[model samples]
Target: MSKGHDFLITVKAPGKLYIAGEYAVVETGYPAILVALNQFVTVTVEESNDYGTINSQQYKENSLYWKREGNNMVFDNRDNPFHYILSAVHLAESYAQSLNKTMKCYHLNIDSDLDSPDGKKYGLGSSAAVTVATVKALCRFYDLPITNDILFKLSAIAHLDIQGNGSLGDIAASVYGGWIAYRSFDREWLKKARNTFTLNKLISIEWPQLNIELLTPPENLELLIGWTGSPASTSHLVDAVGLEKAEKRSSYQEFLDLSKNCLFKMIDGFHNHSIEIIQKEIRINRELLQHLGKISNVEIETPLLQKLCETAENANGAAKTSGAGGGDCGIVVINKKYATSSLIKEWKKNGICPLNLHVHQIND
Candidate 1:
């Protein structure tokens, strides 16, 4: 990277949607596929004269003043409305300091389109996107050389510190962008590394079993998304499933094995460019999630999500609930032979809002 200059630097990180392997992906080395959406969280950094300030358009109350105190950020507000951003800044600066880079006061601003105009989250991994954006923007502001791998590790650690639990495939999508086949590394390993290694050393080392691969969709396949107008808390749903994991260990292991098989088939479908195989695996993955929900006593698919999937099935498309679904969005995989016009119309009539979103690539 070139030397830092007194100029505004902005970075945009895209949000993500899970394609398959939701709950199972939480386990280390378990695979999942996720796509980065067109929606984004943007962060800009510029030099500041006085006390450093953090401003956010999506969260007005989160705007706060802070100052550096011996390499640590001292904030004026204690509520911490923007924990992810704050955590990202701290980690990025800490990494930069380890390299003997100078840290200066800068004003950070965030704007997001990952939510509705009314500030409703679209369940598109806004928190992860924001964390990635913040880290990327600060890296640029500090003139730090960073690759996508280093960025992913840095942003993942920052996000995980706040969230406490998640598969963090969304962080991979945000950092890498586009259609990515992801499997999370061991969080326990990360926790141990944090205590044993420095931020720079931690980022430099390879994370065990963390894999991310960009994928290309088959030429005949297309994707469609429908929002149920009800936002679901992924953390809560994951926690609920975690509670049942111990009692229903056998069932949970079955879910993991089945989900792994289903996702591998879908990935092979991608590699071979077989739309038929992909669609079939999509349906099978849906059934797996349903079985998981039943055994865990968690509603992975809500009534509206069920309606959405059935409507798509009637239109000759394969559909399933996306993410830790209680109520959120469902994804449909359709062949080019099937026109989505009638399916979208049916969704509208049933009160499900069809999202005009596409896969987001890093080059775009």
Candidate 2:
């Protein structure tokens, strides 16, 4: 964390998935199990003389530059694909300024291995990963503390400002980077505390009692992830479900309770590599997704997703839509005894792309 030196700072944060508990986690502070993946979004910061610039392949523009306006770095162009990066920079600079520190102008380069070869997002928490990486890299470039507690909180607050409402399990997974079980922070509480972010208040205010735990996958646990050739807007789906939760209170609560149970079981199954427990829980979880979809009148499991799940079931393995579903990646896990070559081939024949993914570890 030495300052007054010219150096390039790069930080990579891994993408993540909610193995279970999606809708329920948004209810203030509910538990969800999220696993960080090998795919990552990385941010690199280097010193510049006049103004700051950011470059990324994800954006159609591909290059973004900003100049400081008084005490802020305002982008030359406001609407772009790289708002996550800009938001991170704004929050970090604001946070640092609050502590009587200032940042240097730098060229920020953002890149990711989180996309398929064809450049489709697989619903792997790309926004969350990018935000975490950007904030962490900026913190390092400016010689700020690189602790998980600091990084996670900064990234979560910045991202929440954009999305308005999210469980933010993705932020935890990217910061911690592993198979983590997370409970949402009290959104209501954060709303009350947003405008009072002095260092003393940030220190004294207890963070939402988040329950995040690392778990080891069963030694024999084998997982296969595949994309349905379509991406889902998690925020959009969450909003739809939120509306339904308000409209149909009793049924939504029932869905929430069932999802909570399934998440706990999946965590236990992963701990012991119990195929029976894992497989059973995944089926129940899928049913819960379908039920929610029905009640919310949203397509949780797309036709392609349903086909993939059905194929996995016929192969005697467990498969379900991961993340926000609708149209994104589906995960299948089974005991090593089952052969998956044919199943994978079936998935491809049906237009699903298999992803070479694994659980990622925390970056040291």
- Which candidate comes out best when scored by lDDT? 1
| Model 2 spans with C-alpha error above 4 angstroms | 1-6, 60-62, 197-200, 203-205
What global local distance difference test value does model 1 have? Answer: 0.92
Compared with the true structure, what per-residue lDDT tens digits does model 1 show for residues 131-158? 9999999998888889999999999999
| Model 2 accuracy (lDDT, Cα) | 0.83
Q: What would the per-residue lDDT of candidate 2 be over residues 154-254, giving only the tens digit for each residue?
A: 89888998888888899999999877888888877787777667743563356876667887777777878888989999999999988888899999888
Q: Candidate 2, residue 237: CA error in Å?
A: 0.9
For every model shown, the clashing-pair count is 0, 0
TM-score of each: 0.97, 0.93
User: Which portions of model 1 show Cα errors greater than 4 Å?
Assistant: 1-6
Candidate 1 residue 172 Cα shift, in angstroms, is: 0.3
